[model samples]
Target: MTNAADARQTKPDWSAVRLHVVTGKGGTGKTTVAGALALALAAGGERPGARRVLLVEVEGRQGLAQLFEAAPLPYEERRVAVTPDGGEVWALAIDAEQALLEYLDMFYKLGPAARVLRRFGAIDFATTIAPGIRDVLLTGKTCEVVRRRAESGQGPGHGHDRVFDYDAVVMDAPPTGRITRFLNVNSEVSGLARVGPIRNQADAVMRVLTSAQTAVHFVTLLEEMPVQETLDGFADLRAAGLPAGGVIVNQARPIVLPEDRLKKAAQPGGLDQAELEAGLAPVGLADPEVVTALAALAAEHAQRVLLEAEQREALAATEAPMYELPLLGDGVDRVGLDLLARELRRQGAA
Candidate 1:
């Protein structure tokens, strides 16, 4: 098994991959990393024509739009826009009903049955509200993207017409609390479909997920709670026999101040006193009391820095492959995403 720590140090060669699944605890910036990785893969393409890349979000959260600085994507797979190098980036927010309908259309020839099932609350509840069933449909749709099929334009009536499209698929999957169960739907479906079409489809999806060609990247922050969750999530993935990818430490502090420097800065007789006196003296307002007040301000900043370092250290202890994306002062946008893409490429190259 590949260690997470090493994976963090190494950047992924997207050219060699077909599927990338991004997941983590909520608010850990998983979606941001997914978008950035897609951008990086697109930007790093060898040929400049236009590599087809699909960005899939399972929850309909519209997180990709925020990363691209565009509007929320609809349920369907739409050609949103192209990357800088002429590579295509298509975004899809998977609606459970649409995915189920697509699945039925492709497999069961249930054209009219789709609407009938929806009206009877069978398809609606199964695809939307049902726990494991929704996951099955979502994974099924993803598998369709990866499965090999011939393109003869024949409908389900022919039973031999299928299409395999898209160069790469990035799934912005569910949070850590539910992701294991979501991805394990194949095992759940196996009990029902002993050796039929559904079983075959589930097995194919499972193979891709478990294979070395695919990866599952977890994103987290440098805080205590998120780091703890990341550790637990890794263990869960391992226990479930899923391939564990590297962990992304998002919004990490760029510089860490040692204890000695932090203590010196917080001291009353440190740089703050002399710096304040120099400025005040120029204004003819030098006061010992004002110097003390300025020193307190510096001390507060030093304390915050110390706290940030502590958080970073706590995260580093996980020993998982870890990549840190510095927190931008102005917050993340398209330009920020592009910057992150460059960083990912650098890491992937390393």
Candidate 2:
């Protein structure tokens, strides 16, 4: 387990990857990290033209829109923007219905069968209310993107012969509780398709996921519940034979004040009396109670800093390669996203 300081020092090699799946406990800023990573890869000016990056969201959460400051993406892929090196960045919100249709059309050539499945409650009930099925479908769709084949003029090649056209795909996958099952759907499909097309497809997807070329990163905050969940999630992924890529601690606070300075501030009457009087005199705040209140605020900030340190330590114990993204005091927007992109590059995540 590397401490926060050490974790920050270590750099991630993003060049050796084709897919980066970002997930964590809900509200842990998983979406933010996913967006930042996509931007970072796109902004890799020295690399070979950003490598046709695709940012995918499965839950229709509009996170990409919020991060990019653009309109929410529809079911299909849309060219969002160009990267610094003129590489195209495409964004998509995965619609289970559409993915299902595409899946049927590509493999089964099942014309109108997709509509029949929806009308007969097979697709609707299975994807909407079903627990594990929705995860399987979403995960299947993402895997499909990673496995999509380019046109060969004659016909699609065999499973491994088809080369992935997209350089990288960033998936803002499901939350912590469901992500394990989401990534492990090959086992489920294997049971259903013993010797058929689905079986082959499942095997291909599993191959890609388990390969070193693909990575899954979990984004978390330095908080108690998220930390615990991240630990558990890591264990689940490893147990299921899925790759445990790395951990990212989001919204980390800067330890601006040293411990000795913080302790002195906590001490009663530790502040310089003359300096306090001089600083408060200009504001016409002569009351000792007001000065005490101001001092208390500083003390509170110091305590929060200590709490942040403790949280970082707890997160470090998970032993995964960790990255810390600073807390943005100002709200997230395009400018904030640009800052995050630069930070990711500096940390070698790009």
Candidate 3:
């Protein structure tokens, strides 16, 4: 068995982090990354070292369920997937309306009157006239989950079922464009409630948000706009005093050709067709049309490689730990998620 020194050396980069908030430009695979992170965190351990983590989706898109190929999830947490180490990854899709009802019940004992409020357009009124309350309710519920303790008095990673304890919580948050405002709920609701439960809840959420226990990671592709947005999002996090996590570059394509050929094909005038035809001569596939097609493909690959290198340089300025996930040839599935989780573990993102 490994000793204590090896265990300490193997600790993850985010070992102190309990709340992981993932956001990205749309199509950057934010939800996918969040799910993979949960899997990575929960597994990667032997019997007594296993962990249980919760993956929450707050956008009401039910996209988390779709990512896992499960049916639509209610507001309640349920076991969506079990990790290789027998740990659990529970999922919850938080709905604004349901969260509002729960908030009412928690503070005011609304009982059946909560539904009455919903029936008479109170939900709409709160959402429209006092939109900030919506944010307060949603974030408050998430904080509640993050702070919950186990009923059995067993902390996480103890080889027993943790009824309410989770080692970490991963949220698939909004797109980068709105993530700042979405997370800074205290400012959003300051005018709505200065000293009431709403303000208190908002304050509590912010406390967790600005603490070392929380980290907001940005997912991005190696494209211009996504990379720029990732940079901007990191700046926003710094301004908000929220903890920023890693920059996870997703759907990264590999550079297949050798350096010499890649440089030759990356020229502005495109590839040398006659030279490419000779390269294909051994296969009896050196026709002019085939040569032209091959040259075009090579040119595209070269351009992509060169652009990706430029973006990588841009991402370097962020100074955050970087993690890259490969583009799955067959698209993302359970197996794809497993592969990504392994990569995350190998990269110390777990």
Candidate 4:
């Protein structure tokens, strides 16, 4: 909290949330954030023991599997990583065609017909011509898991003791540009089906989506374009009556120099070559070109810091609970993911 980007609010209380939908700009690392979030939620409960969280990929990119350094995931739920406290982070890449098939089997018992359609390329044609069908299928599958209950059914009488299949579900949803349409697809379907099974399914998904138990968090970088998209995405969520969750700033460069020093170095002609050479002289050797190079590097860092500060200010105006993730020097691997998960826990995002 000492140096967080937004200080207007405290960390969100995620205890009530069961579905965490993460989306962002194309290059904002939304998938990586979703992966880390699954780990944090699984490991950071109040009385955590054997907690299982589902990390679902709707884009079919197997981004989660790659982040965990595993083979490409199937449509089935596969346990990918074990949390520090022995909890599990299971992953599943939700394929649209497969989801459609499952939907037919679950509610309509049309497995045979669906398979036949797939073989005839009807499923592909339908999904392509009506993309909303694909999104509906994917979101439906996600909600199914969010609402799944434990088979034991031996919890408290008031439902406080009831166990759930997963502690939470984190989705690597589509980019912000298309998230509104993707999430709101069910409502569109309602227009076509008034009171049939499809209508019921759409209504059910909407109920879960617009409820307090679901929150859509946005991932962004401290830059102009991504920040603008984040703002627009939040506005869309509000207009569509969707719940807005936290604002996670990913890969934010650390603020090395203090405020006054950074401002001084950022000013025009503030960095002097002679002064840089004098500072570098203490090292074994220093040359004029080296001084020039060092001065340019310091100037660039200073300017970047100043611009990033401006972007942070813009985001702070949203008044959303914010969290920052540092840029991994070695890139996001299994080790890097563990580091990020620990950071989320320390920041109370879990």
Candidate 5:
């Protein structure tokens, strides 16, 4: 019991954070990182309980479904997998058209008007070309679920079976290039929607977005462009009055060389050719040519080691909690994703 108390005390205190918005440069594997984060948060507690988290995708790309190895998800929520601590993860791909219809039903109780709107090009035009409306709908739906209030003080699986009563909601948001614009719905709709239900919806979403309950995490690679994008994204979130979460460095490679060897290799002509040749002599390759080649290989590895160190330093300068996901030799399959989830939990990203 003493040990249990200590462990509980040391656990990451993210209970107040209910919404996690993940975005990064394209091809940074932000989707995979978001899925793993959801799993980590769902099972973050040591004791198994009925905690549940929702994973959402808004681009209609079916990326979340692909990561979970499930069929494409409809707008409706469905159980995707169980976390290590027996928590549940529900996935939803928020189709713009469906979200619009749902919004109408919720606001106007438009039973037939929704079908009529779909019959015309209104749905397509609004979701495709109506600037900022699409963003409002996407963000509004996510925030609505995040801020859902259970009726009659009932829990999940109780009186009303509140489906949206999740402990947290992790969104596989748009890439860094569009994330700020996507999330800043209030600004986007301020010009177009001044005083209507649309404006009201945007305002409601902004309240949740700017609150401490929400955090937008950026995923990056240990490279120049992605790191720059992560920094820019962080700045944009701050400017938009949104809370910035930790920095997640994905597909990070470990430094294979020892500290002493790395230091020696960094110096000019510091490697001893004779020592390399002697080490290779046991394998019947005492040739000077072989030694030179080995030395070149070491130098190349040393350069990478130095570069990785510089990248990590830049990331650390952000002053946000930094978490790293290792590059799996085998590609990110189901088992690999689970391994990543465990790593995230260990690093306290949950």
Candidate 6:
């Protein structure tokens, strides 16, 4: 696949992937991972005009806004970040109610009638009282944006046109628990609309969703529950025939202790006070209190390393290509996000 930043460089592995849906267990940092992936795709094509990528959130949460350090986003798409190569990451927060209105306007051309439906609570029924339509609208709108083209500036007549085109679209999708139902448009709309425009719409959306052009990436922490969720989620995606992408392991702590040292530290009271004091003596006068503190620190490091190893092993069982993000000592902010994007690019997730 061509690089997201440069159409010239061929990185065929992920270049053909047009839609990237990121989902994981709650609190696994899927939103942060999604944002960083967008930035990575946005890096590297400085010479030619940079390619554009879109980031979307659908859970009514302002996660994208928080990560980008921007105000709460409206339903409309807006430019949120610029990459080193001048590529752009545009974001959208899909509001269920607004998407329904837009759907009516686009296909039915409801015009003033839309307000009447809203006033009488019909809009609420279709978007909320009713099931599946809301999910349809959310996923449908995202697919539409994925397929939308740039304005050619020439019109056969007077009609609205999409102003921008994206090389790829990244969705910070719902948690694993709800994701299958959320993306399974056929199942969602099956009971509600059997044979109408809504069903047809659901069909189109599913076509895009299950096609090779789209990939569903699962993010997870290197722990038991999240890893198990990742495994289960992948199983569901496979059962549904959805293309599963890579596994993103986030907030991984660094291994500070070397093997021999860690082995010694693992033993109860193995760190000798005299040895610690001797080491400290080179820098300055060693104290009994300092040696005790150092010994405690060694034990902690040993425990963390052992835990991390177990978690890493659990994550490896999933067999999906893995991408890891470091645990930022400082809280995650826009700058930290940029650093993460660089790491992702280096790891070839872009």
What lDDT does each candidate get? 0.70, 0.74, 0.84, 0.83, 0.83, 0.82
Candidate 2 per-residue lDDT, tens place, 253-337, comes to 7765567766666576655545666789888985788877767776776767666677777766667666777889997876777
The model with the greatest lDDT is 3
Tens-digit lDDT string for candidate 6 (33-58):
99998887777743233567899999
RMSD of each: 5.7, 4.5, 4.8, 3.2, 4.5, 5.1
Give the alpha carbon lDDT tens digit for every residue of 1-350 in model 1. Answer: 12233355454544456788889888988888888877776664555644566788888778787777678788756666567877666788887788777778888899988888888888777744455667777777876665534355442112322233556778899987777777877767755677876677677778877777576777888667777787787778878888777677677654444566568775666555676688789877688987787667667767666665566566565555566676877888878877876776766621
Error of 1 at 273 (Å): 4.0
Q: How close is candidate 4 to the true structure, as a TM-score?
A: 0.92
Model 2 scores a TM of 0.84
Count of backbone collisions within predicted model 3: 0
Regions more than 4 Å wrong, model 6: 1-12, 45-48, 153-164
Q: In angstroms, how far off is 300's CA in candidate 6? A: 2.2
The list of candidate 2 runs beyond 4 A from truth reads: 1-11, 45-50, 119-121, 128-133, 149-163, 187-195, 265-287
In TM-score terms, candidate 6 sits at 0.89
Which of 3 and 5 is the better model by lDDT?
3
- The clash count of every prediction, one per candidate, is 5, 0, 0, 2, 0, 1
| Worst window of 10 by summed lDDT in candidate 2 | 153-162
In terms of TM-score, the best-performing candidate is 4
Could you give candidate 3's per-residue lDDT for residues 1-350 as a string of tens digits?
A: 12111233334789888899999999999999999999998885653445788899888899988988999999888878887667789899988888998888999998899999999988878887887887777777788888897766443434466544888899999899888888899889877789988888899999988888898999999999999999999998889877889889899887788877888888976878877789899999999998988888988998898888888789879888788888999988989998999888877788
Supply the global lDDT for candidate 5: 0.83
Residue 264 lDDT (model 5) = 83
